[model samples]
Target: MTRSTTDEAAVPPLPSPKERRRLREAKSLSEKEVAAAVGVTRATVRSWETGRASPRGRKRALYAKLIAPEPAVKPPAVKPSVVKPPAVTPEAGAAAVPEAAAAAVPEAPDLPVAPPVPEAPPAAPPADPPPAPAPAPNSDTRSGAEAPDERRVSPAEAFDELYARTAPGLVRQTYLLTGRRALARESVERAFELAWQRWPEVAVDRDPAGWVRAAAYEYAMSPWHRLRRTHRQPDAPPTEPGKRALFDALLDLPPAYRRTLLLYDGVGLDLPETAAETEASTPAAAGRLMTARAAVAERLPELADAAPAEQSALLHDRIGGLARAEHVPVPRPARAVRTGSENKARLWTRAAVAGVALLIAVTGLTLHTAPTHYEQPISPPERVGGVPPRGGPQKLTAQDLKLQKSLSEQLAHGPERLVPQLE
Candidate 1:
């Protein structure tokens, strides 16, 4: 009996749903039959074949079995004899094949497709709104207003004004204090230099001139100035015959008495002002002034030879000459009193002025002559049982009183006496 051959070429497996549908149609199996064989519902089988779903699990296994290849059947054993065909030439065999069949099949024409338009990226969400602008500064705000610069005057301008107003008086005062024209100039100049440096703070002072005067006095009294004055003493010795005599008498006074006398009398400062300037108490200043006055009294005999008008003229001349030598301008005289029917008023005014002038003159004279009183030898009172005499009535004979009065007058008018002695 002839054996049937089951080794047909295996068909290529379907790759997609469309190929699977074609394969199912070729199989001629109804959707219901395929579903029953694959152990799935008809709808499932239809979906699988229609590409809506894919077979899985038992259904996939069953479908795979249904399409599985049949096993090859063995043929009856045949004798090994074979017949050989004649060899064919390459050209003759190639020519026997149809030209259309030998030529390569053209690939299906590529379908033209428009390039996909790229949708612009969705507009970025708008950025957070910018932070609100800062509020404008108010005109009233402290930071908004311009700061004022502190006003100040130049030192030169200030110094010029000060010098113009004060230089003459200060130089004159300094000459009187030092009794040396050059030294006086130096003192006033130095005081002005110091004032220049402190003008901003000092210009507003109630008495700027007075401040300068005090400063000049302080400078004149300094130890350095004292040393300088001592070094310059020879050069400063009074040259004028009259002044030389006065200076000689003044040199006889003790240093303390001379200083007090000069400051209180020559400088013409009040007792309290003199004390304050000299760093002394009022009582001490008074004592010094009195001592200077007494010293002048003791020297009065020689001084009295000069006439009173001569004495006044000499003093005025010496002071004025010293001031000029020191480069100090003299002050202008005060306005003269007017003469009118108001004679009584003028008389009273004159009297008051005269009284004030007299008081000043007396104070100056007392201070000048105080040194003489201090230097007078005090005779020891007759002791009672060795106890010193208590404060008894000061013994004063007529002659002694007369001598004292004469001495006072001489001291008051003497050209030779520039300073008084201290007791």
Candidate 2:
């Protein structure tokens, strides 16, 4: 007879607990073991196999895949069995085998012979355990693989990329603040160099660029830079007659106030960020900006009289023109002086030479005044006990005589005896 074909061929059935147990056993696993692998209880697996319940959702899909038989290669089809058996009553069927065999039926392999059924049904169902907790975010599973593209790049590489992208803007910002192209370049380059050194730490910081800018501003305004500036005058060429008034006005302000104004108004940083960058309190930074505004107002009387847009344009032009002007580069301090070790060595050599000169002078004076003989002249000794010319004992003072008398009197009296037996 031709084998019956059905819609089941197109849509596979989910595995029953018994089927799962059989498959698991064929693959060397028990019902409870398969249940544990699928993160469900043995009872749930059992219910599914017995046709008492059905597996659902992702779990059902997993169950179907686990127990589905491999497709057969082109093998000869087998004929159905010809033997027929008498229909038994339900009670008779129940009494065919022991209860244990029924329970163990789920674990049986798909062998030719069927196991006998039990007289009694299996025991009451086991209690349902609590549901498992949800998996944490981004947890990988056994079958689920991570995508290659999601891997992170190294911090150094990332910092290098960011530096390349932002360096020009950062240089422009520095130029606006200092109005000196060389100083701007030096400040921006130094800041980036320091950032590159600590890229790992800086990469993790919330605002790495801001941190760099702050560091650059601090380095530019340091006492060392101030001292260097004091020795060498700025070489910025005289501003043209049109911009001369504005240039002088800006130069007149202290560097701290100038930085605050430039960062806020010129570079377009908000007050708080400008304050933080300049290491100034917000109020102080605001006051500096106000003072800068007033100074600009005095010099560019047109700004006070012009519309707001005109005033903005005028200020920008003045600051931008100053930045474009050729200013004398602050020469990198001479390498020997910058290193400091050479100066320190020279100082020590001078001190050593002075110490040696002092020592020699003292020694020479001592040698020049050296005594011919160390022994003092021996004067004739005073007579003692009428002995002739012997060295006499030291003379006693009046106070010594009194002390001697008291000691002599006390000794002469013999130590006062303690009173015999206290009464």
lDDT of each: 0.57, 0.63
lDDT of 1: 0.57
Q: Give candidate 1's root-mean-square deviation (CA, Å).
A: 56.2
TM-score of 1: 0.33
lDDT of 2 by residue, 128-202 (tens): 666989876577743666666577687656766666666666665565445555666677667766676566667
Off by more than 4 A, model 2 = 1-147, 175-181, 229-231, 306-314, 317-423
Single out the weakest 10-residue window by summed lDDT for candidate 2: 330-339
Off by more than 4 A, model 1: 1-158, 225-232, 249-259, 297-423
**Residue-wise C-alpha lDDT for candidate 1, range 1-423, written one tens digit per residue:** 223222221222333443344345446555677777878798776566545787665556577666444467989876643222234444332323333432322233563322222332222333465697776654433464554753456755665666777777776666555565566666666666666656665666545776677677667655565566443562455566655545555556665565566666565556655554454545788898676655654554543455544543444455445445444434321111111213545677899999999999999999887875446689989746867757868889999999989897774654665797899
